[model samples]
Structure formats: C-alpha cells, structure tokens
Target: MKITILGTGGGARAHTAKLVELGHEVFVGTRDPEATLARTAPDIMGNAPYKEWLADRPAVTLMPFGAAAAAADELVINGIDGHNAVAALSAIGDSLAGKTLIDYAVPYIYQHESEHPWPTPWGVMPKLDPCDTDSLGERIQRALPGTRVVKSFVTQEQTTVVDPKAIGAGDHTMFVAGDHDDAKLQACELLRSYGWTDILDLGPLVCARGMEMYAHMHSAIGFGLNQGFGGHFGIKVVR
Candidate 1:
C-alpha cells in the first residue's frame, strides 16, 4: 500500500516508521523541506540517529505536504495534533478527495497549557467541542465532503499507540466509527498492522460521539487513579 502521513511530529513520525517497517511505500509531509533535511542530515550521516531510526525499517520518502497528499494510493492517515487537524485537512482537501482518510484525532490536550495528567481536574474534558456537536471526525468529514473518513486510534493515548503491549493489563475498547464499509475494513487492517487485535466498530461516523465520550471516561480514570501510570485501554470480547 502507498501510505502518506500528513504530519511531522513524533507521533506522525512513529506512524510513518511503523508503516515503513511493514514494507509499504511511505512518505512524510512536512512544512519545510530544508529544515527537515538539515535536522536529519547530521544523524543520518554520522549513522547515529536517523540511520538508527531507519536502520531495520523500510525507506521513508520525505516530500512537501502537497506532494505527499497527491501520491497517496490506498490510504492517507492524518496524524497532525488536535489544533492543527482542521487546518491541515483544509490545506490538502483537494488531494484528499475520493481517498480513504484514516483520521486519528482527539480533542485532547489544550493549547498553551502545560503537559499534565489525563482528564485534568481543571475541567478540560469535553469529548467534542461545543461547535463540533457531531465530533471532530464528523467535522473533518464535512470539511472534506467527498472523502471517505473513518475515525480510528482516537481512543488510545500516545503511549499505547507506539506500544500496544501496554494495553495487556486490562480489557478495554478502542472504538471505531465510520460511514464507509470498505474504509472501515481497510482501517481495521491498518490497526492490526500496528498490533491492535481488539477493535469495536460502533457503526457510522456519528458514533464517533460515543467513542469520544469513551475517551473522556478513560482519561478520567487515568487522571483520577494513577498519576504515575500512563493511560491505556484495550478490548476483550467473550462471544
């Protein structure tokens, strides 16, 4: 599969690396080409960081955000953080048309705030913003209009996303909701590629409201229970 991830943060980079590991042709979208090269050149040359980062992994091609969007074939996973998601999609909406977009977004972590525990006590937990009564996924779907949007991986924290093994301690659910059948199936396959076996598909994109609420509950538990322990959840079905 030809996958292009439209973000360059650590989580976005991690997704790119994992997909590359699966032998898929991968491309990373970034704002500045020169800066990305300059930052990675030292490590790639000294065979220290970038070399080690991609040592056993497949080759990841870096391109401008526009080109990456244009080159995507099977899927285009949006990995930008909360605040930037809408704008990022807007910037590349044309290329995203008719493509199956695997959206991984959450209303997590407020801007201009220090990193704190999950479900912070300062009244930060609103599953969907007031304007987005339908949820972020639905908003993006509306923004794209023609794109097939499936919301996945929003229920899990960054820690669990990079390491699914952390979900071993409990039986929790990673809720998925999308209107398209083929898109959901493809997303399920991608989730399994990341070692996530247990998935609960909650019908169409509107179910994303429930999924986001579930994230709120999970975050509350993490903040209220164990501050030292990171937030993690996985599903167990007995049927």
Candidate 2:
C-alpha cells in the first residue's frame, strides 16, 4: 500500500510513522520539500523541525504535494492544516483523482476577532469556517469531484487515532462519514489496521459538520482534564 500524507505537521508525521511501521510505503507531501528540509526552528506547535524529524525516519520519502499524491496507490491522507487544505489540495486535483482521500482536517481560522474569545494555553481557540451549513470534507469533495473524500479521525488526537489501544484497550469508537460507501469502507479498513475494534458510520458527508465542529469541545475536554493542548483521551459512542 503506497500512502501519501499531504502535510509535514505533527499529526501528519504520526500517520506517516505508523503507516511505515505497518509496512506501507509512505510519501509525505509538503509545499516545498527543500524549504521544509531547510527549517531550523520548530513549528508553531513546537514540534521539532521537519528536517530533524525526517532524519530519524529514513524510510519515509518527502516530495512536493502533487508528486506525492500521484505516487499513492489509492489512499491519501489530507493532513494539511485546515485553513490552507482546500487551496493546497485543489492545486493537485488531477493527481488525486480516483483515490480515496481520508480527510482529518478541521477548518479552523487561527486569527479572528471575537467579542467573547475562547482562550487556551496555545492562545485563543481558533474559529471554524463553513462550519454549520458546510464543512471542510464537503468542500474538498466539491473541489475534487474525482476524489473520494471521507471525513474521519478529526475527533481524536493523531497519536490516539493511529494507536487506539494506548487508551482503554481500544474500547473507544471511531467514526467515518462520506457519500461514497466504498471509500468509507476503505477508511474503516485502515482504522481496523490501526486496531480500532468499534467504528460507527455517521452517514453522509453533511455529517462532517458535527465532526469538524467538535473541535471546540475537544479542546475544552483537554483543558478540563488539565492535559493542555493535545489531550491524551478517547471517546466511545455507547449503544
């Protein structure tokens, strides 16, 4: 399975490392591979520079966004930051045609003026755009009509997403929603490969609104637990 993850951020790295461990060929997409490799300082999230991280993961190949997407066998994970994802992915639409894009991005606008701001340890909580009526998943699907977009993995941290058993022996439930049944099945197959025992199909892509909107609540939960930033936890949908 050749997989392309279109981002160099922390979350993308998590998926990249796990997929490589699962014996899948992983290609990471970045805006500029040379620029990414030239970074000396950590990212905004304080994660180590991309070059430093890549040095340790010799198996992972890094390439420009389009090239990486074209190299995937069928699956591509859109790990690009929510705000910039649509534009970035739209540029590589041709490369992604006929592929299953499991999008885990939340459309967050990091800089905004709010009368009542929701502040976290990492600064003011970002606001979601196209939140209620539309969603990033739908936007991506609209942008790339030839691509199969499935909204998932947005409800949990990437670490927990890739290795669910680390929390509660993987008792928690993962969710997937998309208009394409076969694409959702592909997502579920990957989730199972990651050891997810329970998965709930949340119906159509419109349901992505709820998933993306859950970002605020996810942050609140982390603050409530005193975990700060990325909380180490999981949620189970009890029947």
TM-score of each: 0.77, 0.99
Worst window of 10 by summed lDDT in candidate 1: 43-52
What are the per-residue Cα lDDT tens digits for candidate 2 across 4-26? 99999989999999999999999
lDDT of 2 at 30: 96
RMSD of each: 5.3, 0.7
lDDT on C-alpha atoms for all candidate structures: 0.71, 0.95
Q: What are the per-residue Cα lDDT tens digits for candidate 1 across 27-140? A: 877766556656644431133333345445547877778789889996998877656677778788888888898777675545334355334455444434523356778888
* Predicted structure with the largest TM-score when compared to the true one: 2
* TM-score, candidate number 1: 0.77
lDDT of 1 at 188: 85
Top-scoring candidate (lDDT): 2
